[model samples]
Target: MNKIKAYGTESHKDDLKEMTIERRDVLENDVKIDILYCGVCHSDIHAAKNDWGNSKYPLVPGHEIVGKVVEVGSAVKDYKEGDIVGVGCMVDSCQECQPCENDLEQFCEKGMVGTYNGKNKHTGKQTFGGYSTTVTVREEFVLKVPTNLDTKAVAPLLCAGITTYSPLNHWNVKKGDKVGVVGLGGLGHMGIKFAHAMGAETIMITTSPDKAKDAKRLGADDVIISKNEDEMKKHKNSFDFILNTVPVKHDINPYLNLLKIDATMCMVGAIEPLEPMNGGNLIMGRKRVAGSLIGGIKETQEMLDFCGEHNITSDIEMIDMQDINTAFERVTDSDVKYRFVIDMDSLK
Candidate 1:
């Protein structure tokens, strides 16, 4: 084991502070990463505050991690020292499960180990995430990052990028499909970019008219103010697919009304319970609603490859590790333009 420098909150209500944590020695199938950048996800704030009720204290909450490989175990043939790599929301899963066999380890039947706040399958110790100087992960769970894109901006792709990319790729969204990306936050922004890049006529569905211009700049082909009665009615039953990225509970019935018969709307956000929906909305049109989690390792690599090809990366603001507490506050207040990433060198 090695004591590594990191920043984490000791209590739910306490501010994040500098601390030292232990990382296991590299195992036969493991790779040790010198973490360069880690994205600040909204879920990080949620975990830090124990909002989901499963958070463990002294939490190191970053999952969107990007860095360079400093060491590789003898059995790790796919990665080498000096190679760029990444780790997302998951670090390990039971490989015997059907999901794991199918390359969908995110749905591992035995429960996938999270990057942080999860029990390590091998050591039975709490996993520390990427808000630190280094991390050691299994080769299968580690990702090969494309060197072509902006390394700093590429960190969010591990979480926000893959979270939005999975649903679109699974649904096989294609050319000329009229796709609606609900909300304009981190997830929603990536949804728009993916839908547009996939050749769909992407529309931004939001309550704020002021966001329309910014949404267009992010690849949205058009804007629909959901609060406008005439505008909502005009586009009713016209969408081929809708990706709902609203993080909080709200009435989804209206968004339901915008889908075409036989089309589906997938929820990638708002993990909480939502208000009851009118059954008629779905029964009458045969429209469907579904949910998706982040993609598995194989698919995450694909998303990274796609991003590399298209030069896609999140709109991010860079911050020193010391400012993470303030960054958390800004994220809670919805004050950031999009996402925040920490430069781990600041900790040195």
Candidate 2:
């Protein structure tokens, strides 16, 4: 084991503070990363506060990691030292499962190992994440970062990018299709970018009027203030697909009513219990509601490659390790323009 500096929360009530944590030494299949920028994901805050009811203490909460390979295990063939790389939400999973066999390891029948606040399959100890100076991951889980993209901006792609990309790719969004993206937060921004890139007539649906300009700047062809009945009515039964990225508990019926017959709306947020909706909302139009997690490792790498091809990356505000607490509060209040990325040099 090797000691590394990290920032983590010690208890439910405590703020994040500097600490030394042990990272596993490079094994035959391990790739060691010198973390450069780690994106702040909402789930990190949720996990740190035990909002999911499954957090482990001294939690180092970060998953959207971008770094450079500093070392590679002897058996590692795909990666070498000095490569730009990244790690996402998952570190390991039982590769024997049916889901894993199909490259759907995110749905592993045996629980997939999370980057942080999760059990390590090999050591049987709690795993920490990218809030540290370095991490050693199995080569299969380490992704190549596109050299053309800015490292800070690419950080959010590990989670937010893949989370949005998977659903768009699965539903086969294409040219001339009308795509609606609900909520203009981290996930929603990526959804808009991907949908627009797919040649869809992308629309940003949000409650905030202030987000109109920002949405258009992020590739949204149009912006709809969802609270306005007239605006909502104009688009009713028109969207080919709607990707919902709103995280708060709210009435979803309005969005449901906007779907065309046999149209689908995929939910990537709203992890909490939501207000009930009328079943007639679905029965009448044949609308469907679904949820998606981040893409599998293979798909995640594909997302990075696609981003590289398209020059797509997140809008990020870089922060130092010392401002993590402030960043958390800003995130909770929806005060950030998009995403926050931590510069690991501060940890050093």
Candidate 3:
């Protein structure tokens, strides 16, 4: 075992602090990464604090990882030392499952091993995440980072970027599509950028009119203040597609009623059990509400390639490791611009 410097909470109530964790030596098909920047995902806060009810203690929660390949096992064929790479929410899954065979490992039947607070399939040990200085993952689970993108900004691409991109790609969003992105935070910001780059007429729907200018700056051709009945009425039955990224529960019917006939809305947020929906909305307009998790390994790589082609990345506020607690509080209060990224060098 190799000891590496990291910052993590030893208990659910404890704040993150300097610590050392053990990383297994490189095995066949394993690549060791020297983590550079780790994006602070909202889910990370949940996991770190055990809010989800399943979180394990001594957790190091981060998945939006961008790093350099510092070592590769002998069996590793494509990657070499010093290559830029990334790891998302997943680290491993049962490859023989139908979902894995179909390159949708995110839905692996046997349970995909999450980057943090998940049991390693092989050893039944807990897996830590990118809050650490280094990680060793299977080569197949690792993704190639785009050579030209801003390495720091690109960190969120692994999680936030792919989370939004997969739905847009799956729905075949094309030029002239009227796309609605709900919310204007980390995930929503990426949705707006991706929809705009896909040549769609991007509209950002938010409760606050204050986000209007910021939405336009992030590539929304138009911004609708959803709280205003008149503004909401104007876009009724208009959107061809909607990406809902709000984590809190709200009246989804307004957004549902605003979808054009046969239009589909995909959700990348709201993990809690939602209240019953009115079937009338769906049956009347034939609108569909679907949900998507982060992309599988193959689709995630494709998303990265697409982002590279379009020069898309999250707008992030960089912070030191020590500020993670404050950042979590800010995130809960919705006080951030878009996303937060932790400079791994700060941990050292």
Candidate 4:
């Protein structure tokens, strides 16, 4: 193991500060990365503050990583030094599970290892994440990123990008289908881009009238104010699919009322219990509500390739490593335009 510079909190009550963390030495099938950018995620705040009741202290919270290959172990063949690559939420998993064999390691029966605060499969040590200068990961978990896109903005694609893409791809959202993206933050913005790229009539559903202009600029064909009862009723039973990206618990009943018969709305955010849902919402039209997690390595790679082809990237605000604490506060207050990405050069 090698000690590296990183920013993390020693306890739930403390703010992030510089510290040393250990990363495993490159193994025969491993690749070492010099992290260039790491995107901030809302989960980072939750984990850092122990909001989920399952967090470990000394947490280095970042998973949307984009970097350059700086070293490779003897057995590494798919990547070389100087290759642009990425690492998302998961770093390892039990490959013998049925899900892994089917390219769905995110659902591995033994549980997939998270980028941070997860038990490492190799040494049984806690995993560290991309808030540091470097990381060494197994080749199977490393992804090849497209060089054509802005690498900084591409960082969030590893997380926010895939979270929105997986559900649409699974439900077969296509041209001529009417799609609604609930909420207009990090995940919702990407949802609009992907749905538009897929040729769907994308609509941004939000409670704020102020978000309408920005929503349309992000590829949404139209906007629906969820707070406006008249607007909500006009679009009822017209949506083919809805991607709910609200990160906090709120009532989903009204959104449910807008789905067509046999239509579905998939939740990619709001991990906690939501307001009581009305059964009549589903019973009336055979509508369905579902949920999705991040995609597997194969699907993540595919999502990146798709983004490359279409030149899609998250709208981001750049910050230095020293400003992470302030950035965290801004994120919690919903002040960022979309996402925040840390430029690792400050740490170097």
Candidate 5:
């Protein structure tokens, strides 16, 4: 065991602060990473505060991690010391499961292990995340980072980027498709970039008209104010695909009406039950509503490769590790332009 410095909330009632965590020693198939940058995710805050009622105490909350390889176990292949790499939402999954065999480890039948707040199969200890100084993970869960992109900005790509890219890639969204990205936050911005890069006519669907200019600047070809009846009706049944990124509950009926016959609307946000939909909307058009989780490891690597080819990275604000509490508050208030990434050097 290796004891390392980290920042974490001791309990739901406490603020994140300096602490010590134990990382497993490098096994034959493991690679050790010296943490550099870690993106602050909304779920990180939720887990720390026990918002979902499943948070473990003394939780180190960060999964969007990017760092450099400092050590590789003897059996580790495809990576070496000093290589830029990343560790996303999953650290381990049952490799023998059907999903793992299909390269869909995110849906492992035995339940994939989260990067943090999960029970580690090796030690039976609660897994800690990237707010720490170092992390040792299996080679399979470590991703190859694109050295061409801004290293700091690439942190969010591990989570937000993969979450959006997976669905677009899965549905085969491509040239000549009209893609509507609902919401304008972290996930929505990436949705716009991916859809645009894939040659889709990307539209930003939002309730706020003020978001239009920034939406366009983020690669959205057009903006649709969901509140405007005239504007909503203008694009009725014309969209080939819609990627809904709204994390909150709202009437989805309006978005459903915008899809063409047999077209699909995928929800990447709002993991909870949505506002009741009018059955007639789907019944008449044969429209489909689907949801997707973060991509599997193979797909995440593909997303990274795609971003490398297109020069895609999240627009993020850098924050010191000490300011994580403040960053968490800002995220909950939706006060950030896109995402927040911690400069782990400050923690050191």
Candidate 6:
């Protein structure tokens, strides 16, 4: 084991502070990363505050990690020192499950180990995440990052990128498809970019008219102010797919109404209970509403490779590790342009 420098909150109400934590030594098939940047995700705030009721204290919460490989175990053949790699929301999973066999380890029947606040299978200890200078992960769970993109901006792609990418890929969104992205936060922003890149006529559906110009700048073909009755009616039953990225409970029926018959709307955010919907909304159009988690390891790598080919990365604001408290507040207020990335060197 090695004592590594990190920043974490000791209690739910306490602010994050510098501390030292233990990371396991590199074992066979393990890769040790010298973390360069880690993205600040809204889930980090939720976990830090124990809002989900499943958080563990002394929590180190960052899952969107990117860094250089400093060491690789003897059995690791796919990566070596100096390679840029990433680790997303998951670190490990039971490989024997059907989901794992299917390359969908995110749905591991035994439960995928989260990057933070999850139990380590090997050490029987809680897994600490990327709010630190270094991390050691299995080779299978580590991702090969594209060198073309700026590494700092690429950090959020580990989580936010993949979360939005997977659903689009799964639903097979195609060229010229009419795709609607609900909300304009981190997840929603990525959804728009991915949909547009996939050749969809991407539309940004939001209640704020002021966000329209920004949405167009981010690859949205058009913007629909959801609060405008005439505007919402104009797009009714016109969408081939919708990626709903709203992070809080809200009425989804309006968005559901936008889908064409047999079209689907996938929810990638708002893990909490939502307002009850009328079943008739679905029964009438044969529209479907589903949910997706972050992609599995294989798919995450594909998403990164896709991003690399397309020169895609998140629009972000950089912050020092010490500024996390204020960043948390800003994130809660939706004050960021899109994403926040931490320069881990500041933790030193």
- After superposing candidate 4 on the true structure, give the runs of residues whose Cα lies further than 4 Å from its correct spot: none
lDDT (Cα, tens digit) per residue for candidate 1, span 87-190: 99999999888999998999999999999999987788899889999999999999999999999999999999999999999999999899999999889889
Range of the 10 consecutive residues with the lowest summed lDDT in candidate 5: 42-51
**Predictions in order: lDDT:** 0.94, 0.93, 0.91, 0.95, 0.94, 0.95
Candidate 4 CA-lDDT value: 0.95
Q: Higher lDDT: candidate 4 or 5? A: 4
Give lDDT for model 6: 0.95
**After superposing candidate 6, which stretches have Cα over 4 Å from the reference?**
none
User: What RMSD value applies to candidate 4?
Assistant: 0.7
Model 3 poorest 10 in a row by lDDT: 119-128
lDDT of 3 by residue, 280-310 (tens): 9999889999999998999999989988899
Judging by TM-score, tell me the better candidate of 2 and 6.
Answer: 6
Candidate 5 local Cα displacement, residue 275, angstroms: 0.6
On the 0 to 100 scale, the lDDT of residue 73 in model 4 is 96
Once model 4 is optimally superposed onto the true structure by TM-score, how far is the C-alpha of residue 238 displaced, in angstroms? Answer: 0.4
Q: Name every residue pair that clashes in candidate 1.
A: none
Using Cα atoms with residue i matched to residue i, what is each candidate's TM-score against the true structure?
0.99, 0.99, 0.98, 0.99, 0.99, 0.99
Model 2 RMSD to the real structure? Answer: 0.8
Candidate 2 local distance difference test against the native: 0.93
The clash count for each model shown is: 0, 0, 0, 0, 0, 0
**Tens-digit lDDT string for candidate 5 (1-348):** 999999998899999999999999999999999999999988898899998999988899999999999999999989999999999999999999899999999899999999999888889999999998999999999999988999999999999999999999999999999999999998999999999999999999999999999999989999999999999999999999999999988889999999999999999889888999999999988999999999999999999999999999999999999999899899999899899999999999
Error of 1 at 47 (Å): 0.7
> Across residues 38-107, which tens digit of lDDT does each residue of candidate 4 receive?
9999999999999998888788999999999999999999999999999999999998989999999999
Prediction 3 TM-score vs. true: 0.98
lDDT of candidate 1?
0.94
84, model 3: CA deviation in Å?
0.6
